[model samples]
Every structure is written in structure tokens, then in C-alpha cells.
Target: MAVFGTNETKVMLPRNIADGMIKETRTLSTIAKLSAREPQRFGETEYITFNDFPKAEFVEEGAQKASTTGGFGSVKSKPHKAQVTMRFNEEVQWASEDYQLSILSQLGDAGQVALARALDLGAYHRINPLTGSVITGWDNYVTATTKSVEIATADADADLRAAVGLLLNQPTSWGVNGVAIDPKFAWSLSNLQTKNADGSPSGVQRYPNLGFGTDITSILGINAAQGNTVSGTPEAADTKVRAIVGDFQNGIRWGIQRELPVELIRFGDPDGQGDLKRNNQIALRLEVVYGWYVFADRFSKIVDAV
Candidate 1:
């Protein structure tokens, strides 16, 4: 007797996506609005802006072309990373403007979708997936208990010299590598504020362009303060960098945005003056290089001075 009864209830699995209809909506455009505090898309200017209003621009890093005798033997320079500039319209008249438009910023949800999901995304900065210590000098983590020493002035030979000694005293493994500062901080003291070591007061200071969640606790809190003490008074008012000397030396230098090889930090005032409201209408602006992580706005470029 040959019993050949088939098992009708064999367990099966979910079918593949043959229906041609995607169920999930994976994009940033679905959202209506994007704000800074809750960033989703950086509104405006793109390689193709006619499609997306506000328009985004993409600039390339300086390039060096090298000819060689091989298949496509032309060595091209590294294209810079991505960036954007949001011009905060200060005119209170335009109620739709964002007064505190940050020069560099992350994208909002809608913008992210347009560039990522819709467009053919390539060599553009999406988002930093990896999160680590904000300051990346020492190859370790800087705790909240470290002490921060402020130069309180400009970049002086004395301040740099002092920094060397101070960092040497930190607990061995606390990202205690050589110190880093805002390129502006480095320049402010070195060129503009350069003072004679013979008679001039120590006129240089290294501003804090550091990587931290908040506050310079680990640095300022260090009991055996050596090189890393938070220098100049870091304070602000009326939503602007109030102290120019301290601003350049410390405040502006320690912006939330961190960069490499150079960090261009700008300090502005309403009446077109600096900290003490120096008239002449001179808005302090310059490039800070040789530091790290600094990049251009809407341009894929990194300016680093050896």
C-alpha cells in the first residue's frame, strides 16, 4: 500500500516585494517645517536649487593636479567636505527671517530627504554617524573634572609656552595630548597681539575651541591647574559675543561647531563694533587655520595653513 497524502499546511513565509508598491515612506520631505533647535533639513541653495527654493551651493577645495604615465594617471586633490551658510536676516521688519542664522549648520528633515532619498546623493556630508569626544587631539576622552586655563589676552609666546607646561601635568590618559585652540585665538595673540617678551606684558593667549557637551568643567575644575585653565572671561549678552578680547581669545574660539586644520570663528556686534563697542565700524573677521575640523560654508573646502 503506497500512502502518498500531501501535507497541505506546510508553514510558508512572507512574500517578496512583488506588489510594486512600497509601504513605508522613507524621506525628509514628508515633514512640513524645519527649525534650528530641531534641525532636519538646512533650508536653501543646492547644486540644483531651481527645484528646491532657498538654493544651496557647493564649493570644492583647492586642488593640485599631478600627471603620471598610467591608466588615468592624474592625481587629483581631495575634494573638501560639505557645508552651508544661513544668512540670518537681522531686519526685524521681515518677520519670516531667522535673526540668529548660523553660518554653518546641519540639515533639516526635508532638506535631508531631498538630497538623500530623492536626489542621487554622492560626496555630500550627510551626518556624522560616529560620536566620540568632541576634542580629538589626545586619542582619549577629556573628563568633566579637568581644569581649563584662560590666556585672557592674545596669543603670546608666554601663553603658548605656558600651555605646553600645563598640558604635561594632566592625568596621563585623559585626552591629555598637546592642546588645541581656535585658529583665530592662535592668530589674535601671535600676529595682532604679538608682544615683546623683553618688556611688553605677556600679550598672547590661546582661546578655547574645544569639544565638549557643555561648560569647561574638566579644564577649569582641575585643582592642579597647569596649562589647560580657561583663560579670558567667557561671557555673552543680547545674543552676541560681547567681549572682543575675550571673544577672540576665548568666547568665539569656543563655539559649539568644531573643525579641523582651521576653525573660522567670527564675532559680530549690532552697531558694527567689537566687544567694547569700538566704533570705526570694524567688524572683527579673519580665518583661523592649523587647528582642526574647520570647513567652509556651502563649500566643500578645508583651508589649512602649515
Candidate 2:
């Protein structure tokens, strides 16, 4: 008799074409949106860098009498060696194909989101770092001369205004033209009220248009934006950077490489037993070179408001 029967039942395997898809998650790139991008050139293994020179001092003319040897200011570019990476698994791509979705597009989107978030955080650290801590971009050139203002527990509105006032006091005529506030703090600020002569609520609103849905786009005639990355510990006595106000154009610097480098290898696996080969997946990587600099410390202010 033959080993195999003439009639046999075969097992039926389900195809991946019927799987449902879930909604995408939210990723905010707040600081990146506010920053300016300048391109720089560097080798793949080398760090990116840039320089910022402070303006030379001005002296009163002495009736055409030559001024003593006024020295020139020299500032060197700060090196940015920090890099962030992103990876996508092959299994996820297969599942995406089964679900009738473009895995490559999804991966690209996720990669951009990750890079944006990482860059935003990098900018924040350079701009509003904790007390006694050395800042990245500014520490290299200037001594990271960050200024701050204290806030009252019950009323932060006055403190906020005062903070803005302090920023405007800088010698630069531009003054403080921008501010980045914590989302939670901004929410509380939206409800701030003016006080009566007796320090009681005057039934009048201050910053009536400060909230999320208001028409008032700025606070104190300066551009204002809400960023969750603005760091601050609610219960700790340590210095928390809740808000940052400044002439961002002259205070903050963002540098981009020649291009946003993205690479994908559909058949990176040569053998059929390696991780990629066995998993039947492709490979993807993102590489970017950039640098950041804080030009004038006095041009910026960080608020430690709780």
C-alpha cells in the first residue's frame, strides 16, 4: 500500500490581508518648530560645530583722538557630538503589508517624530538648564549666564509679567521678543486675574486671551509658545526651568547638516540565517549632523516658576 492516502485534508493558514489597524500616537515637536535651522558640513564620524562672536564694545570718540588698543572679541564654535538613532523591525513591516498599510511610510514618519523630539530636547537643555549645571551650546562660548525670577504661590501672573520685564531690561534694544512656557503653567496662566486695590479679585481678567482658545497670541507684546519640554520639578526645591523668554533669534542657534540623512536597505541580509534574513525583514537608519549655540546669555531669561 502507498504511504500517502489519495484523499487528504490540508490545514488552512490565515493570510495577513484581513488584520485591522490601530490609530497613530501623538508626538509633539514643539521646540523644533520654534528653532531656526542652519546647515553645516562634517564627516560621518566627526562632530558638527559653529561659532558666535559677541559685538565689540562701543566707546565715546575723543575729538578724533585714537582710542587705546581696544581688543577684539574671539569666540569659537561649539562641537555637537550627540546623535539619536531609530530602528524598525521587519516583522512590523510584514504585519503592515498584511494590513494593507505602507510600512516604509510609517517607519519614516516615526523616524522623523523621534528625531524632532530629540532635537527639541537638545535645544531646551542648551537654553534652560538647571542651576549650577553647565549648558551645552552656551557653556562652550559664554558662561551660560541664565537669569530667572521668583513667583508667588497664589499669584503667578505678576511674577510672569515681572519675568518678561526682566528679559526686556537687557541692553539689546531688541529686548525679549519670545517666550516658551510649560503647557501646565500656560493653562494656569490663562485664568490669571487682575487684583483690586485691596489685593482681592477685581472681577476683571488679566490675560483674558492667554488660554489655549484665545485670540491673544502673545503675552506682553512678545511671541509666546507652550512647550512641555520646559523642565521643572513641582515638589523639589531645585531650580526648575518652567518658562524661557528671550530674543531667540540672537540667543538660540540651530544648525542642520547638508541634508536629513535617511537610509533603507530592502535586502541588507545576504544569508538566509542571520537576524534580518531569518526574520524576512529590511533595514532602515537615520543619520543627522547638527549644532546649537546660545549667543547672548543676557538676551534670554529662564523662569523657575512652580
Candidate 3:
């Protein structure tokens, strides 16, 4: 029966709930686990990246030492706002205290999942999750890098190895440190089979230790994480990008604001989905700021041939 439309009316999510959401997001988002994180403020944050390493030279004693030029550039991170809003029955407001807490917890979980997916989609695919459209002027990993390895059905292991090779072979020697893969691609890795002398199925899995659980911590000795958002469903007949391997520590960086605002809407159609008061429904919205930048061509994508 009350309308609240001001920032003062907004509720800061409980610290525990916010912490839980951040933990779940990091666990679920491969990009978050693989990339470096830098502190970011409300405005743009700039990072310096060297294009060329300084050369070391041997100089005779007292001889003039020449200065070697090392090219460098700056990359700015532009914060992108993300939000998750859910509508619930207004009756829950009067429900038992435990029930209300349960509802809030569930909402937090949903927000984390959404944020995880958004991080992958935006950083890997340059997609804006809210609109399901490519973000203009933003180049994601798959789009920004020319290095790629075609997935080989006969040797999935070789494909990944080659992908890693691409990163290591960069001009600046970008060593592969982390791999982010789609669940489907992760399955393919897990299903790699050993062959007999005659090339028959040896009935032994090549990587018997590999597990296809919700969390895939490692692949081929490199840290890894799994999420469907790694390889979004491509349009029909398009080359599907399956995985990304790179020097995430030095090649890419991301940051999330510490503050997460949660607002309860009691009236009006915030989502253009009819008035909440008339529908006897209340909406909970959680919003956060996220930013990222790919500073080098140190990533290689594994893609299926069209």
C-alpha cells in the first residue's frame, strides 16, 4: 500500500546474502576465476599494458648505455550495469519471518546465477545479457583475438593443446595459465578414449581421473572452470566457439563493485509488466556494476568448423 521510489527507500542486501552471491558468482563464472581482478571505482579505470618488452644489453664499463624503447598503451574499463529483478506474491510480506528469509535467500541465489552468466556472456561474447544483444564498441575474447584452433573430433586433446599453444606463441609470449570451457566441451574432454595398438577402443578412458561434475577445477594441468555461457548457442550453421584458453592473469582483467543495491517495488510498472499494486505482486531488484578489458591477444578460442 506504500510507494517507494527513492534511493533512500532501497535496501542494501544483507552482508551475508551479498557475500554468498559473490561466492556463487565466482564459482560459476569461468571468466571470473580465470581473469585478473583489479579494484575499480564508479568511473572508468585505466590499466597500462606494454606492447614490447625492454631489451637488455651488455655495455662496456663507462660506455654510454643506449635507451631501448618499450612500447606501451593504456586500456580503460567502462563499467557496465547489470541487474536481476524478480516478482513475488505480495502475501509473502506477511508470511512467517523464516519464510521471508528463505525467499530472500532464494532470490540471492538467483541473482548470483544471473550475474555469473552475464559476466561470461559480456566478457567472452560481448553480449549484453539484459537485452540479449551484442554490446557496441566492446570486443570480447572470441571477437578480439585472431588466434583460434579448430576442434578436432579425432583428437580433442590435441585441439586443446593447440589452443594453448596459440597463446604461448604470441609475440609477447602469453603463457597459458587458465582454461574456460563449456560444459559440452568439457564432456568431450572427459570422454577422450585410449586406443589399443590397432586403434580399437581400449575400454579405458584416457583421463580416468577427470570428472564431469558441476565444478571442473582442472584440465591438462591448467586450472579450469565450466559454464554454458562460455559457448553461447550459435545461430544455425555457424562455427560454434567451444572454449577459451589464455594467460588470464596478464591478458584480461575484471572488476565488480563492492556495493549491491536491492530495491523493493510496491507500486507502478517498473518492468512494464502491469502495475504491481493491481496485480498483488511485489518486485525485488538487485543491481551491480561490472567492468572488464582484454588487454592482449593472449587468448585463443577453440571452435568447431562450420
Candidate 4:
């Protein structure tokens, strides 16, 4: 005899659904791989922590040893709760196996898309926030007064060079040096011209080999990417940050306190008359507990205008 009951189904569903949802979420979210990610243990509480020490310097063999002060440092990120819920009509509970399978697949796909966008937007805001209103001053914003760079002007190459130079000039080594630019600026870059020493047209194209299809993969020997979310409005003249260049892996820290989990509640709908008749719809909740931190301001440089 086969053993199957409500108790067994509930236990199995959460485990299987959580696994499938995590896989789907990763596939749909570019931010997962674009930045650094740290997984938290189950039921762990409090904030995630990161520590870094200074590099050792040479000292005389018999001389007093040099103390690497300020080398020992730490930062923390408090995990925030994020959730999505999908409700299925009571009829789905009794529907055919094929019908049930179809609905579940659709729900999973939609949920993943929603979660991915949320994460991408969160990273965007931190990497490029409003000029004077930066949330935590974590964004490495650049301006004419600060770094002498313009975002929406004809001289885009100069701005890019400035941002890239900042990252390269940092004292630390970078694991992944790349840049994320607004699509509009990227389009502007594609039209850049190479001028002659005499101020005449050199007939040489700056970004002659740049491609805008799907995504801008590379530029000027560095990994280049384009996304409109990097700024609020690419056309706005405000202090909108237009582009960023640096070691994203060492800059952005993403933390997860709990893996995504799917839970179902049959008695969640008290408004429906079916609740009293034991035929109410099922309430599906998808949850993810995560947080993010931008460490080392020098790891990222932003191009903006004031």
C-alpha cells in the first residue's frame, strides 16, 4: 500500500519548491552573478559581517616592528525580508494533474522575475544614488568639482577615462574590473569620433567595433555593460549617476540569511464562503531573507553630473 497524506505532502512540497525556486531565481536574476554573494546558515540571526586586514610592509630586522594600524576593520549588513505571494483559486486544488502542473510552473516563473527585478533595482540604487541625497554615501559618485567628469556631454570618452582611471589608480588590486553605463551613454559612446592633432576629423572611429545588441559586452579592453536602471532618468539634467567602473566583485556584498522557501496555507481566505466548506483557495507565499553592502568606496567610481 502506498503511503500518502496531507502531512506527507506539506513536508515534501516546501523542500522541493524551495530548491526549484532558488534555481529559477538565479537563472532570472543577473545581479546574483554580477556581484559578490554570501550564503547564511539556516536560522542564523543578526547582521552579516565582513573583515579586512592591511597588507604587511617591510621593516628592519632589528628595528621596532611597524604596527599596521587601521588594517583590522569590519562592516556589517542587516538582513531584510523580501517576499512574494501567489494565490490560486480553490478550483485548482481539485483540478487535473496537468492543470495543476501548469499553474505551478507559471507561478514559479513569475515569482522569479519579480524577485530578480527587485534585487537588480536595489543594487542599482546603491551603486548610483541621487547626488546630494546618497542613502549611505556608499556610491562612488564623481562630479566636475569632485573629479571633473560630465555624464551627459559630448565628451563622454573623457568621463569614462576618468572613472576607469579612478578604479585603476586604487591602491588595492581588483579581481574583476568592469564598467556599467546607461544605455543612452553607451549609445553616445558608440558615436564617439577620433580627432586629429590639428582638431580636424581623423576619420577613425573610437568605438568602431562596439555592439549594442542584447547587451554591450565590452569596451576599451574592459568588460562593459549597459542598463537603464543605473540612473533614475538618463535624460534628466539632475545629479543622476550615469556610469560606474570598478571591481564589482570586491565592491558589492550580497548576503542571504535564508534560502527562498514556498509555503501554502489552506485557511488563509476567510472572505470566501468556501473557507467554511473546506474548499477555499490555497495561499502560496515565497520568501527570501537577504541584504547587501557596498564595501571599499575606492572599488567603484561613478560618473555623474551636478
lDDT of 4 by residue, 46-153 (tens): 343324435577888888887774434455554556566666675666667667666666666777666654554555553222232334643422221133245655
Q: Name every residue pair that clashes in candidate 2.
A: 38-256, 50-77
Clashes per candidate (backbone, < 3 Å): 56, 2, 0, 0
lDDT of 1 by residue, 120-189 (tens): 1111111211211122222211112133334444434345444434444534312221222333433443
Error of 3 at 37 (Å): 2.9
Cα lDDT of model 2 by residue, 202-306, tens digit: 766677777552333477777766655555222123336666766665556555543433344444453333566556665544444556565545444445546
What residue pairs are clashing in model 3? none
Assess each prediction's global lDDT (C-alpha) against the native.
Answer: 0.22, 0.49, 0.78, 0.56
* Model 1, position 270: C-alpha lDDT score: 29
Highest TM-score against the true fold, candidate: 3
Order the candidate numbers by lDDT, best to worst: 3, 4, 2, 1
**Compared with the true structure, what per-residue lDDT tens digits does model 3 show for residues 1-306?**
222223445766778999999888887778878876668887677888777887888899999998887888888877878888899998877777677777778889999989888877877787777666776777544446888888766677899999888767656686888888877788887887899999898878788767653467888899887777776543112227778888878777788954887888888998988999999998998888987777547788898877
Lowest summed lDDT window (length 10), candidate 2: 17-26
At residue 56, candidate 1 shows an lDDT of 36
The better candidate by lDDT, 3 or 4, is 3
Candidate 1: deviation at residue 230, Å? 12
